[model samples]
Target chain A: MDLNIAVLAGDGIGPEVTQQAIKTLNAIGEVYNHNFTFKDAVVGAAAIDQTGDPLPEKTLKVCLETDAVLFGAIGDPKYDNDPSAKVRPEQGLLKLRKSLGLFTNIRPIKAYPTLIDKSPLKEDRINGTDLTIYRELTGGIYFGEKKLNEEGTVASDLCEYSDFEIERIAHLAFKAARARKKKLTLVDKANVLETSRLWRKVVTKIGESYPDITLDFLFVDNAAMQMILNPNQFDVILTENMFGDIISDEGSVIGGSIGLLASASVGEDHSMFEPIHGSFPQAKGKDIANPIASILSAAMLLEHFKLYEEAKAIHNAVEKALELKVVTTDLDPSSKYTTTKVGDFIADYIANSE
Target chain B: MDLNIAVLAGDGIGPEVTQQAIKTLNAIGEVYNHNFTFKDAVVGAAAIDQTGDPLPEKTLKVCLETDAVLFGAIGDPKYDNDPSAKVRPEQGLLKLRKSLGLFTNIRPIKAYPTLIDKSPLKEDRINGTDLTIYRELTGGIYFGEKKLNEEGTVASDLCEYSDFEIERIAHLAFKAARARKKKLTLVDKANVLETSRLWRKVVTKIGESYPDITLDFLFVDNAAMQMILNPNQFDVILTENMFGDIISDEGSVIGGSIGLLASASVGEDHSMFEPIHGSFPQAKGKDIANPIASILSAAMLLEHFKLYEEAKAIHNAVEKALELKVVTTDLDPSSKYTTTKVGDFIADYIANSE
Candidate 1:
């Protein structure tokens, strides 16, 4: 098999961590006897510095023409601190998502046994907890039409959803549920919001086709509470943009470390995999940022292409790293592992494993 | 001193728990030598069954005529299980809030020493957690204009905020912070939403007037995560309606049990106190429901009227009940204490304590 990948290692520790993911992917390609080609592209602050545009035309072209996009982190304090700045690094990724038609975001939250004690939740509560959030990324409040009155005293944002928008994400969530635990929980404020009622109606209609999968609904507030109280009860959790943003971020902490969470944003024709963590500006050249999130994102990319065995190999390597305590300072302050060293260990394990 | 209290024990366990609260209030009145009068009214499913209206005009009249209101839980499984019901038990509370102009919803979350172990979070994460959330109750998306397109396929809800709405709540939250830890964390999605930016601007301006209080900002997503990761880091949390609903509910569980959470909704001219937990229909007549939340709500009512000494007495008595392990089944299933027994103990403690 042949794979073409577009790499956008944006800023700060992004380049350092993304290099590790690429190294691990190369190892997988070697062991599996596959051809993997990579094309480099500038994005975010780095692109802004070079071309005065965060998502340069050539960069987007590379992403569009590739099999999948392997994205690192974006954002920079230079842009973040200047709130009045006309152009920002975040707008680049938002534009890319719109250009590439990336609509649905998938976030998988799992509590690894070795790290259960590190979670804020009790071991009994967090143990064996595995849930994936299917968040509708493009079509909710975030992208809604916003208004501010001439007096600047009143501001408003519209949260709108059409049946088409709900159908696309619902189908993907149902398919994911069918492949997993055969259960799906739709999080919404159906009793309050008209858009939520539409979401429930559309998701319910879609659920009928997948008769084997169980469908349930929870109000967003109740879902937020339930996420902490009993995380193990969920399988594939689906929600719209704003609710998803809050709940998925809430779910991210249950896994013990933000450094280990990865996410994927997909559309009909394209998908992008990236670590959920931001570019740690303070850890830019420190060789200390955790690489596991980036590496696992590569694993998700493999899974997207139906390379199950290859994905599993990366997963096993990651599990071995956790078991051996070969982690960066974030996971283990006493360990003598650099970002590159952790990547090397995982890549070696992938190549040498039975 | 004279106090006229309106009691609207809506449905299910509402009446039972409210009885406990009324008993405790009576004990406070006797100890403090204050003249207390009680008026009864119906709301929610009970009101619907009796008067065919959730919030009967007679009930609103009773509430408006009183100094303050003591609200028990609302909602019934019958109304909840029916999707097509035109009048829901929840609408009663919504109508009441709107009619009373209850713009600010205040929920205090504290991790009691005795019940800390009951929390799903680890002891270290949840212990010593004390925070208050001032949620804007009457505005934002919940009350925003909603629309469904002619095709019945598109739906939208507008999230709008005005300077007046933000200012009123900001002053209350700032006053709250001044009375406590002198720190105010305003949660909003300012980077994305126009309304949030308005919130940040308004809060920032108001925060300048509170020079002693350290004011900060957090996106709603980050606020949701921080509520669980490090709850003690917060002093006063101010947010819009929806974010408050989610985070307050999330914060409710950190105190070990929702059975111990109390909330107060206040406007300029009116206020209502209630337990955060819903009416448990299963325990309606079983005498097993927890009354601590309702009793604490009564304490809050006293505090609202500037009856600090009387409120402290109720708090001390409730704490004594928890200390003595005279809790309901939710906190301790094997406990032999019934709802009335726990209420009796609290009232007795208030009356007998020197």
Candidate 2:
């Protein structure tokens, strides 16, 4: 197989982390006898600094021309603190998603055996907790029509959902659940919001086709509480964009550190994989930031290409690194392992593994 | 001082737990040399059974005539399972909130030393986690205009906020923060939602007036994670209706059991106190439900009337009961105390304290 990968190593520690992911992908390509070509594209604050645009037109063209895009984190303290800034780094990512038609975000959370004690939750509650969230990324309140009155006394955001939008994500979620646990839980506020009620109607209708997969519903409020009390009960959590953003972030803490979670954003025509953690501006160039999430994101990229065995090898390598305490300062603050060293360990394991 | 108290012990364990609150309040009245008149009202499922209305006109009239309403839990499994049920128990509470103009909901969460082990969170993370949430109850998306297209293929819910709505709750929350920790955290999605940006602007402006209070901001998604990761860092969390519904419910699990949390809803004209937990239909007649939340609600009612000493006495008695292992089965499944027994113990403590 031949693949062209666009690397959007945005800012802060993004370049450092994406470099490790590229190395691991290269190793996988060599072992699996696949041809891979990597192209670099500037984005976020880096793109802004160099090209005066957070997402340069050249970068978007590279992403569209490639088979898949591997993204690193994006953000800067300068952009974050200035609320009055005319252009921001986040707008770049949002625009890229819109331009690429990336509508679904997949976040998989697994509690690592060695890292259970790092969680604020008790071990028993977090033990054996593994679930994936299928979030509708491009729709809902975030992208809806936002209006502020002329006098600036009133502000509103419209949360809208169409049947086509719900159906596309529902099929993806149900298929994912059927492949894994044969259960899917749709989280929405059906009792209050018309959009939620429509979600129930459409999802329920679609669920009828997948009779083997059990479908359940939980209000977002109750779902939030259940995420803490009994995370093991969920198989695949499906929700609209806003609820997904909130719940997925909440789920990140279940495994102790956001540094270990990876996500994939996929549409019918395009796909992008990235780490869930933000770019730690303070840790940039320090070689102390964790790269496991970026490495796992590479694994997700493999999975997206249907390279199941290659993805499994990367996941096993991560598990081994974690178990052996060969991690960066974020996971083991007392240790002296640098970011590149930890990534090197994972890559070495992947290269040496059968 | 003379007080008119309306007791609306709605359904299930609501009656059982509320009876205990009344007993404790009566004890306080006697010890403080105050005249107290108790009136009974019907609400929720019980009212549906007797008066064909979840909240009867008589119940509303009684609540209006009183200085404050002492409410129990409300709900039934029958209505919960039947999605088509129009006349539900929750509707009563919604109507009552709107009818009485209860805009700000105050929920105080405290991690008791003895009950800290009940939390899903680690003891260290949950320790010293005492915070209050002032939620805007009657506004935001929950009560906003909802619309569905004629073809039934599209739906939308408007999340609207005005300066007036934000100011009222901001004042209440800021004042509450001043009295306690002098810290206020406004949780919203300001970067995306117009309403949230308005919230930030209004709150930031209002924060200027209270220079002594340290004000901060956290996006709702980050707030959700912080709630579990570092709950002790928060003092007073202020948010809109839907965000409040999610966060407060999530906060309830920090103490391990929902049965230990109490809440107060206040407006310009009236206020009502209730336990944060719902009607436990399964444990209704078992005599095993926890009554501490209800007793604490009564304590909050006392505090609302500026009876600080009386409220302190009730709180001290409840603490003694908990420390002495005189709790109900919910708190101590191995213990032999019943609902009325726990209530009796608390009442006895209040009576004998002076």
Candidate 3:
């Protein structure tokens, strides 16, 4: 089967990482005999540098035409320290989500056995853990009406959610749960936030439509605590954008290394895949930042296309490489291999295994 | 100074743990030459069983009459498993906050060098980590309008925060920062939640009034991650109820055990002190649960009264006692003392300390 992939290597270490992902994908294509085409797009600080628009029309056009987009990291530290800057790189991400209608963000968390000892948690607590998070992407507080009082002294952002926005993501979570462990945890501040209350109401109703699924509600606070104590109890975890942003990062810790995590952000008609790790701008061009997350992202792209065998092949190669200890410094920084070397090892593992 | 302390030993091991706190307080009185009187009150599920009111009128009256209230653990396993129960022991504590106008819940987190290694985090990360959290109590969604659709299927809780609510807590936080390290991190979902944005804006404006205090913002999610990644970076952390409920628990992990934490909920007119840990109904009356948190709560209460020397005396005693291994089983289950035994040792240390 033929697939068209959009590659948006936004800035900093994005291009370097995405290049490794492409190389990994080429290895997968060679082994699996799959046809894949790539289109490059600019976004974030880079898009602003090129066209003075973070989400330019041309970039969105490229994203719209592709079956899936592989995104690298965004944001620059320059934009981060300035509290007064109006057009920041993050705005572009928010705008892209809104424009593309990418309403569901799926972040899968699994603590690999090999890395359990590396986690801050006791090995027993983080061991044998696997879970997926489905965070409602397009709505919630991220897009809410924001106001910084004219004095620039006071700021307020509105967090409003309609039942319609809630239903779509609920369906995604329930569907993801069915394919996993048939359990769904709807994480919300239902005991407090009005938007969260609306989310719970709609999700609960949608849950009834899938009677076979077991569902539970957790206040975001308890959910945060529970994630640390017992991440394994969760199967498909669902939440809004803000909660998702925090929990996903917390979940990243479970993997023992952020570089091992991958995410999928999809909507009713569009989808994108990326590494959950941020731009290690310092790691730019060093060939030292682990590219496995980006490579695993490519694997997830295949899974989205129902190319299960191809996805399994890539995963197996990464797993084998990890067992063999051919990893970047982030995992075992003392390891002799650099980032490109690790990518080469994984790609070689895939090619050899086939 | 003459003071009347209202003591409410609520449930499970409430009386057991509270007894130790009293022992420590009495030691404080004897050693410091302060006049103090203790009044016992009923609250939590036990109060519900007695008068069908969790925070009885008499209890409130006693609390109002007293200079401070010492609260023991609340809730029972019976109430925990039954979600359908209309009135919960937690509701009583929440109600008490609203009724007493306890607008700022202050939780002081300081890592004990002796117990730092007990933490899952590295010693360097936990050492010398002292943070005071000013949680905006009696506002936000905890007191918001809760409604259920007629079908009883859809439950909604409204989270509304007026500028006034944010202003009060913001003032308390800024005051706290001015007195301490002069750094305040406003933890919020400003990018999403309207209440959070309001909190961020109000706090930023409040910072202007106190030029020495450093102010910044962290999305609740990032804050949660940062709390674990490196907690020492913060001095005074201010956030709303829901975020506070979660981050404080996450903060407990920094100290190796929540059992070492203490908290105070102070209002414009009244103040309350309690351990950050809840009723471990299972550990009730077993003489096994740790009471350092309770002992530390007393220390915070003393600090509130401007009895800084007296407060330091108690805190120093606790650190010394823990270093000597006179600790409850929670900290070291095999330690050669029961809960009361450890409390006695601490009280004795305070009394004998020159």
Q: Which stretches of candidate 3 lie over 4 Å from their true place?
A: A77-86, A113-118, A145-158, A193-214, A329-338, B77-85, B114-118, B145-164, B174-182, B191-198, B208-213
| Chain B TM-score by candidate, in order shown | 0.98, 0.97, 0.93
lDDT of 1 by residue, B1-354 (tens): 899999999999999999999999999889889988999999999999998899999999999999999999999988889989999999999889989999999999999999878888888888888899999998999989999999989999999999999999999999989988999999999989999999999999999999999999999999989988999899999999999999998898877788999999999989999998889898898899999999999999998898989999998998889998999988888999999999999999999996
Instruction: Give the per-residue lDDT of model 3 (tens digit) for B45-77.
Output: 899889888889999899988999999889987
Per-residue CA lDDT of model 1 for A247-328, tens digit only, reads 9999999889999999999999999999999999999989999999999999999988989899999999999999999999
Per model, how much of the real contact set is kept? 0.91, 0.96, 0.31
Cα lDDT tens digits for candidate 3, A148-228 = 555544444445667777788899889888878999999887656666777877888899988889999888877887877
lDDT of 2 by residue, A1-354 (tens): 899999999989999998899989988998998888999999998888888899999999999999999999999988888879777898899989989999999999999989998998999999999999999999999999999999999999999999999999899999999878999999999989999999999999999999999999999999999999999999999999999999999999989988999999999989999999898999899998899999999999988888989999999999999999999887887988988998898889988987
Note each model's CA RMSD in angstroms. Answer: 1.3, 1.3, 3.1
List DockQ for all candidates: 0.92, 0.94, 0.37
- For model 3, the local distance difference test gives 0.82
lDDT of 3 at A73: 88
Clash list (residue pairs), candidate 2: none
Query: lDDT score, residue B335, model 3?
Result: 84
How much lDDT does each candidate structure score? 0.94, 0.93, 0.82
